[model samples]
Target: MRKILAALLLALFASTAAQAKWYEASSEHFVIYADDSEEDILRFAENLERYHSAMSLVTGRAIETPSPSNRVVIFVAGGKGDMRELTGSRWVGGFYVARAGASRAFVQTIRNKSGYPHFSTVILLHEYAHHFLISSARHSMPRWLGEGAAEFFAASSFDSEGGMQLGMPARHRANEISYAGIPPVEYLLDPKAFVESDREASGSFYGASWALFHMLIFDDARKGQLTSYWRLLNEGTDSLEAGKQAFGDLEQLDKDLKKYLKQKRMSLFRIGPDQLTTRPVTLRELPKGEAKMMDVRIVSQHGVTREEALDLVEEARKIAAKYPDDAGVQVALAEAEFDAGFNEAAIAAADRAIALDPSRPNAYVQKGYAQFSIAEEAEDKDAAYATAMETFSALNRLENDHPVPLIHYYRSFVERGAEPSETARHALERASQLAPFDKALAMNAAMMQAGEGKIALALVGLSPVANNPHGGELADTARLYVAQLEKAEEGTPWQPEEGEAKATGNEAKDPVAEGAAKKPTGS
Candidate 1:
């Protein structure tokens, strides 16, 4: 279970990183860091907030905001090329990760295209749409619909006068639409089948998705069909069956979609600032020292491989040498040190950071990580873990809703050879709630509940992973669990947190087995 929680965190959390001279803009939904003028970053943050509001209006769903620390963090690279280099994909304009403890997006100046003046913003928008939709609905959608809806909204616009266009024509998708054509309805419905079929033909997957979603949004005759299909899927119907039930005939629907794409002009849904209260965005330039280490911060946030960490920590150490007095730099050094497997060095750097700025949350997190890593090899494992738990507890006091603290709190017990107590189990569930987009964490929580015979809670927790639009082996696995549980008895078994837990000693020992460390911890 701790592996389920730690694997992702470790994969994304970095050891060393580079770049600097940054300004930060904070808003309701995002925190933007860029090496640009305050005005530019502010505008970027404002536009993102407006886009968030616009999505709420278009989808007719109320905003479900997260804790301030939990809001998505956006890093504006030096330019689009910079991000492309990081991702190692020339086709990628930008990218994002939505983790339980942290969510982040990265971009650079995007060149505009089509009628959309801000075409540069499309990548993050498309990705964010996926995050928002999945988080909001708490159910999976067909891959086609998920991507289609993201593209549809990604093509939208915000005029100088603050006017909003919800579903403008997706002219950016023209190349794909023309080359790949709309993927056949069957390919759209069955992701596995699509992958098994012609690769080149489905290259236009995103474009085809946009086309179909656009049609569904505007076609008067097909109005509400998408909703019907979504409802059916969530209600446990097979995707193709749901598609046929909602649209009647796939071949006929494909024909209609083909005809629909030929329209020289497509539908547009418009709204104005008067209809939505755009949240205010605040901006500030970072102090020179901290600004200089921002590249390190971004890379650390992006995560890296162990070998990669060895390369990065030197760069981080050099930056720290330049800004030895800076708390941010110290924190960066701590991350880099940890990433490079110098756990004691990381703990020391974290201590330096905390001494510099006691309020910094990540410093404590980094310290906790080093403590936990060190404890793994300690002869007095319980004593080492108890100290590690204190660091996370301090983080909890700093930001009670932070998913990392909640997760690690539960894990601290498990690591100590003791069963997690009622409070620890509840905290684990809450961590899943806070980071619903983190399907892995949710799955682990559900499995823990299932093991405890809390079938209903387990089912609820697993639902989102099963419905994840980016269908994968995990989604398929979760689907099996959901089906199996539903057939067993309708809420036939429920277990309390105290049910079978054998919480030992002082509670932070993770409730079992030091000798098992002689064995294996299967992730």
Candidate 2:
């Protein structure tokens, strides 16, 4: 799925100097955040609205559009470096993250120099396709099919004269297919291989999958097969079996795919006029001080060096001085102070933010984290722990799907020297489901389960990390836990030696620390 690709593609990056301003605009289904001018932001919003309409037609499902209060957030960075700073990946063109019933996208507005049409638009649409599909359908599909569908829709183009084209040849994908060769359909269908693949394999997989889907959709005889395959998958059939039934013969389907790839020219689909929409878009600019504060918050969200942290704090303070009553600015200041290790200052700023806007969850998260960090030094640590837990509890109620709040809620029980209740167990499980790639969170859940003598459940939680050949320290730790669980099952007396079952130290122990850490953006 595109969500999995987003997680794998993200990399850690140190923070940069804070941005000075950002522009904002909105449409019925989307909000645009940019460092560009208002005109450009509005144009992007219009294009996104059109794209949403087009995708709804293609999927045969009406868009499950967000309400006025919860539009998808689109962050259009000024350049490549800005995009990299926000997403933590140098090569990522853009990505979408679904969080707490909202979707957020981070992308660069750079044009491709190789004469490619709508390069940046394609990237955004690719990510949007994932968001739309996930929102409209609650079912699952194979990774190859999901990604192939995204790429297929992403290649769509709208001419200035209002012509619409779909299924255009993807040149880059073709190149990858030519050089790397096509992977077997079985390989692409295997969800495990798709998730753990290396860069080269991933490229080939994407290319081959796209080509396969392109052929199936456009080749008159195979068009219906795509829908059939998806239907079978939805009915709980195994992907391989679904493919066999849908395509009739796996060997013949593979040959057809190879034949399609070798064609020098392919037919493109024209979108009918009925599929297009001409909805009006709305635009608004953020206040100057608030815009500047947004820049500070974005910078603070990424990991930062001490120097960068101090610089961000200074920048945020300048904005706060002008907009002293702004809750967002105060929250920005709190985040920067926490990053710079000024725990008490962070707590005070967070308190101010809460006083200004009681409904904002990030402020509570920051305040709770700062309190938890200093609890050990407090004269009444128990009271401090209780207060911290209470703050996180409020945050969880405000945004139940947010993994950070749930993570802190579970960790609070551990910090308070009490056995985690069933509530804590459910909270960790939900957090893990929401953020499967977070090795630290997964480790914490597995450790807690093992501590409760649920060795089998713990091993189930650790299996993915343990089997990850490329996983570094996390993989090693997971493997160790798996071995311990297996030994215990064998009736061998085994106790974890010193440091054998130690925490990763990277767990989301504090909500502020969790927010500051590199997580998949929007997630």
User: Against the true structure, whose lDDT is highest?
Assistant: 1
> Lowest lDDT 10-mer window, candidate 1?
507-516
What's the CA error at residue 511 for candidate 2, in Å? 28
Q: Candidate 2's residue-wise lDDT over 88-175, tens digit each?
A: 5566655554443234566666332222345556777776776566546545446677678878877776654444677788765767
Candidate 1 regions exceeding 4 Å error are: 1-20, 110-120, 466-523
- With a 3 Å backbone cut-off (N, CA, C), the pairs that clash in candidate 2 are none
- lDDT, model 2, position 85: 50
Please name the candidate that would achieve the greatest TM-score relative to the true structure: 1
lDDT by residue for model 1 (299-381), tens: 66666667667777877887788888889889989988888889999999999999999988879888988888899889998
* TM-scores of the candidates in the order shown: 0.86, 0.68
Model 1's alpha-carbon lDDT is 0.72
